[model samples]
Target: MPEWMRSFGRAEDGAVTVDWVVLTAAVVSLGMLAGVAIWGKTGGAAKGIADYIGTQGVDTTPM
Candidate 1:
């Protein structure tokens, strides 16, 4: 109803800040997703290696 309130409502100065915030959040989310994928695969590979070694046994044991 007030002129000042209407002007404030139409302001564009903070729009860029909002866009940057949203973009930053999206980028961080993608990075986290990639990190989780890599971490999960690495863990699985390590577990597989351990299982193989356990089943095959070490070729030699040190003195």
Candidate 2:
């Protein structure tokens, strides 16, 4: 009913900001998901490599 309230209701700036916030959140969420997936795969591979290296004998004799 007030003049300021009517103008605020018709404003478009806040709407654009809201859209951008939602889009950014979606992108960040996807990145996190990809990171988690990659991390799981790499974590296993890393552990395997560590185990292999740990089992190898070290030759310390001078050539």
Which candidate leads the pack in TM-score? 2
lDDT of model 2 at residue 49? 100
lDDT of 1 by residue, 17-51 (tens): 99999999999999999999999999999999998
lDDT of prediction 1: 0.95
lDDT of 1 at 8: 96
* Residue 5 lDDT, candidate 2, scale 0-100: 98
Candidate lDDT scores, in order, read 0.95, 0.96
